[model samples]
Target: MWDDWARTAQPLKGKVAIVTGAGRGCGRAIAQGLAAAGASVCCAARSKSEIAETVALIEEEGGVAMAFAADVTDLQSVTAMTHATIAAYSGLDLMVLSHGVALAVGPVETTDPVDWQRTIDVNLIGSYYCIRTAVAPMKARGAGKIIVVGSGQGHNGTASTSAYAASKAGTWALTRSVAAELIGYNISVNELLPGNVRTQLYEDTFGQVISATPAGGEPISSKRSHEWLKAPEDIVPLALFMACQPDIGPTAQSFSLMRRV
Candidate 1:
């Protein structure tokens, strides 16, 4: 059944997909993957230069993509991005909220207030804006896929990551609420909780912790762990599957992609 689904499930072909934070990291990978799967992707981010690079890479590989510069934290920018995508593609079929920030090494009480607010604004509020802005076009079409890029920390508590962990947890809960509200419209809303992905974000945040901690003290071991720490490419197939598969059936569910060591 799964093979048959995969074979016949190029439903995303010629469909429009919007991927935020597509400048780099997992977001860029997801955007590229969607485009490769035959979706016309809107690659959005704060940096035009980085988004342009992503678009160039996609076009070089013969995939369709367009770069839109927008800060996900800004509602005006989010609205502009949605409008631009609609103008370019007529309508949106998929919205992937892949952009997020984290300050993982700080203790809750000692964490910088600026970082805390930024994390909440970027991870929680930003996702809401994307979903909220995309809903009208999706409702008009009466169908769409919304994928929230969540984190394993949302499922389980991780020390020294109070703000990031809280924001992701909120994202998961928000996804559930949106899923309930949109199911009648045939919009499948889901969350993907990635574990220890080797993205720039992961490297910047956890890499320091990994480097400082002793071999045995490492949260995710450095040795015999490379195979388990998912690559950005590893995540793309699942995202594509969730977005393209018909009859996703349930709403308000979350899936984890971590391999236990």
Candidate 2:
């Protein structure tokens, strides 16, 4: 099983990583996975209690980690967080921009301006801040890996998800741009589409679990197959694989687990 493999692998030993949105869902899963791979991880998020739980879980598994409360929307907060991670682990080598929001889930014409803007603030701008702050440390170290947890919505259009789509699309573009800019510094930046995992964000936004359909049958969602619904743990392996890649590994590319309908 995957658990057995994780226990035996130490490919990332001595590396230090920072995972945003480490409170729960895919972010928490990735953080735990990185720890299991022998990296010192910093579980960062606005929810102190939630990140504490993540750090506790990592500690319970005998992995090195710490919980840091940080608001990604604020540049100063993100900067302090990056500094703290470096201070704790002596340096930074990996950054995972996994925090996101999908508050504007209605027709654009009828959506609240505040909610729409907030969605962008949290998902797109927050990612920019995290990347901007983390880049300095990584550049200083001469090598780093940045993984952006993107969405299927970014690749194609979908109804009632205008803001979320725009933000993720922007993030995808940003990932490519940053990767190109950091290539000379030996940093690799890539995006990971985790499919439609059954996280709290999914329940709150869709209120329905994506169900499996018969062979060759239509799915519930047109953008992706309903059967793509997965547990957070299902994403860990791909994340670990990307994290374990060489310094010259693929960058500006997207690794997706979601199937198109």
Candidate 3:
């Protein structure tokens, strides 16, 4: 179903977009979704190979996209990426703040403060930097869409996920603040929690599939774990919907595609 859209749709025709962490997983899938919708996309990540892979997939489906290397944690890096996008695609229309880093599950006291801070640096600070830089060009154009990829963890606390949860919670609030700042200017900002994407990162970090969740006993740590859970591809449509920046309201809103079905 998704592959078909990649070749036929043009809903975002001529729009320019930037998707961070696009080298793989959900980021890559969202990048594909944007390109499939006819947006000229710039895929950004720390890995050149992964970014290239994403670009290749888009090209294979006859979509327009390019890869860029940038560390989302650094302001200068993100700034340069935005400027580069302007040079290539003229302007920015959509920005998907999807890059994230996870901390291992352990006792809060056992966690190094440095590790906790690093997680915040990637999941929260990085998002702030990208949002800050992307907004300028977007504001100048008097129109833009910003989608912050939040987590269910943000809504409530869970054991062993303090850093991830806290950071995402911060991101969700930040989205509201940013939306308030730009809503009157015609730009729309919103949050979308892609409920439960089954990406390789989850598999690797958890060492099991979605079934192995904290509440679920004895996780099925195998390829089957990858099956029952929603894949990155499943979240594409919602991300695309957010990309369109639907006018259900003024801005600074939040949406979710929590169900795999």
Candidate 4:
């Protein structure tokens, strides 16, 4: 089954993609997956070294990719990245907004105002910037796909995660709004929930939560942590599925890999 799926998932042969936050975690994984599926991918991120590593890995696999340093919070930077991708590959078909931060992971009252705004800027507004820039190129192609990497916490807030949750919730709302606007243009906008993948952001945010609990009341243990965590590669199939969908495929929707309680 796996072999068959892999063989058939190569429909993106001549497509082009831009993956934000491609330096590591979900962004890097999806960038690699898209390239393996035959799309020329642009690995965009703030970390020059990290994105370079991602590009190297993709090239080593006989895939086409380029590293672009971009700050999603800056509209000009995002626009430059989009233009560069189009200039390099001729067109853009897919964009995966996987860049985010968890800096304001403490009590709401104590959360730094600047940090909260920065979180909103990177996670929510940054998404808007990418979406805005990709619109023209996608419209030029007459079809496109935009995938927003979101979280379950956006649906129901968790304590000490107010800023992060708020930003994601805004992203979810933004996804739907954009999807509706692009319906006639054949542009599919959607959200993808990657669940509890063990990335650095996860370690810093959740680790802080676990350590703050009272003695004998730990919400997560070392052993349980492993069980709950998942590898970034696990998201590849679902992402490929969404990216490979038809022009008239589902939009203003969310595809989740998270388990229910």
Q: Scored by CA lDDT, what does every candidate get?
A: 0.83, 0.89, 0.82, 0.89
Please list all clashing residue pairs in model 2, or write none if there are none.
none
- The pairs that clash in candidate 4 are none
lDDT of 4 by residue, 93-207 (tens): 9999999998766777777899999999999999999999999999999999999999877876666678889999999999999999999999999999988998999988887
lDDT of 2 at 220: 35
lDDT of 3 by residue, 1-261 (tens): 755764576778989999999999899989998888899999999999999999999999888898899998899999999999999999998899889987644446767788789989999999999999988898787789988889877885456667878998999899999888887777888888886678876766555224225554434243233333678888888787677655434477778765322
Give the alpha carbon lDDT tens digit for every residue of 1-261 in model 2.
666687797888999999999999999999999999899999999999999999999999999999999999999999999999999999999999999988867666768899999999999999999999988889899899999999878887466678888999999999999999999998999999987899989887764213322335443365453557899999998999999889988999999987755
Task: Give the local distance difference test score of model 3.
Answer: 0.82
Query: TM-score of predicted model 3?
Result: 0.88
lDDT of 3 at 176: 91
Report how far residue 55 has shifted in candidate 1, in Å: 0.6
Off by over 4 Å in 2: 208-220
Query: How displaced is residue 121 in candidate 2, in Å?
Result: 0.6
Off by over 4 Å in 4: 1-9, 212-228
Give the TM-score comparing model 1 with the true structure, all chains together: 0.89
- Model 4 lDDT-worst window of ten: 218-227
Clashes of 3: 0
Query: Can you give the TM-score per candidate against the true fold?
Result: 0.89, 0.93, 0.88, 0.93
Give lDDT: candidate 2, residue 123.
Answer: 94
